[model samples]
Target chain A: MTVNELIEKCGFNAVSLPEPEREINGCYIGDLLSWVMGRAEADNVWITIMSNINIIAVATLADVCCIILAEGVTVDDEIVKLAGEKGVNILLSDKKTYETAVAVYEAI
Target chain B: MSESLTFHYDVDGEDFTSAGQASVQVKKNLRRLGIAPDIIRQVSIAMYEGEINMVIHAGGGEADVIVSEDKIDIILADHGPGIADIELAMQEGYSTAPDSVRSLGFGAGMGLPNMKRYMDEMTIDSTVGVGTTIKMTVYLNR
Candidate 1:
């Protein structure tokens, strides 16, 4: 499913979107950026509590389909701006990372 | 054949927020050079991991990426405290990064192993009190 479809159905707080229509092909749950970079498949929906700006770099380098910041993590203003500029989609969720991952799995 | 090009970046260790900037720029440069997606992915991933390791452990470092016809060479150099145990550090689940780093979505003990996994060849030169230097290569044609 596309990013917007997940946001609409899953009820996430849509934060920033460079491409809402980008398709998610898989799901990976991890907090370590390097591990995610190595294991997360391209076009996968990355669910994490990390709201830092570096996450944007990981998302772009790893070709992640989108990022779901879970558990009410607040995002930095710079992160939001960079995400928009990088054309990376970031979704905010109050749910735990696992719960959000499950919702993403069921959505697709 | 295209001439080899080298890009240099100074990784800032004091700011965790800016750790991966070098790798991101390298990715963009490679894209402009028309490097293949898969090859770029390999080089960037390995280089990114190395960059993170330098920031987390070495307090910042220097990264140079040399793009050539058959391969891309990444040389990461840092003057921080060196790794005492290369084999142990290379283990997938061993890490010395503080818990705070874990909260930032890193230091899960996967940095070095991940770098090794993505590169075609990896070599580590580390001394206990001096520092560490890692050289890794990703072959374009491989």
Candidate 2:
């Protein structure tokens, strides 16, 4: 499924949808940036509570289709702008990380 | 190779927010050079981990990417209290990073292992009081 389609179905708040049409092939849930960097596959929907700017770099490097900030985690304006500029999709989810992953799994 | 390109950056240790800037730029540079996606990912992810290690442990460092016809070479040098035990440091779950860095989503003790996982060759030259320099090479053909 595409990012926009998943967002529509899951009711995820779109913080940065620079590549809304990007495909979501799978889901990866992790907070450790280094571990996620290696384990998360390209185009996977990454679910995390990491709100720092480094998350943007990790998303870009891992080439994930989008990042789902779980557990009501919210990033500042600077991060949203950076995600948009770097072409990394950012979505906000009120669910926990596991629930967010399950939601993505069901949607895609 | 006779022809090559080199990119250098000074990693700032003071700000954790800017830790991965060098790797991010390296990714962009590799993309512009038309490097393969998988190869670029390998190089960038490896270098990004190195950058984070430099900041969290060494307070900053120098990173250089030398791109050639056959391989991409990354050199990360830091002037901080070096690793005393290379063997222990390479372990997946061993980390010396402070709690502050751990809260930032790093300090998971997977940095060096992750670097080695992506790169074709890795060498660590560290002295406890002096410094540490890591050289990693990723073959283009791989």
DockQ (Cα-based) per candidate? 0.77, 0.88
Residues B11-83 of candidate 1 have per-residue lDDT tens digits of 8989987777888899899999999987887788888888888889998999999999988999999999999
State, as a TM-score between 0 and 1, how close model 1 is to the true structure.
Answer: 0.93
Candidate 2: tens digits of C-alpha lDDT, residues A1-108: 899999999999998999999998888889999999979999899999999999999999999999999999999999999999999999999998888888888888
Which CAPRI category fits model 1?
medium
Where does candidate 1 stray beyond 4 Å? none
Query: For residues B12-77, what per-residue lDDT tens digits would candidate 2 score against the true structure?
Result: 999889778999999999999889999999999999999999888898999999999999999999
On lDDT, the leading prediction is 2
Best by TM-score: 2
- State the weakest 10-residue window (summed lDDT) of model 2 chain B: B15-24
TM-score of chain A of each: 0.96, 0.98
True contacts kept of each: 0.80, 0.85
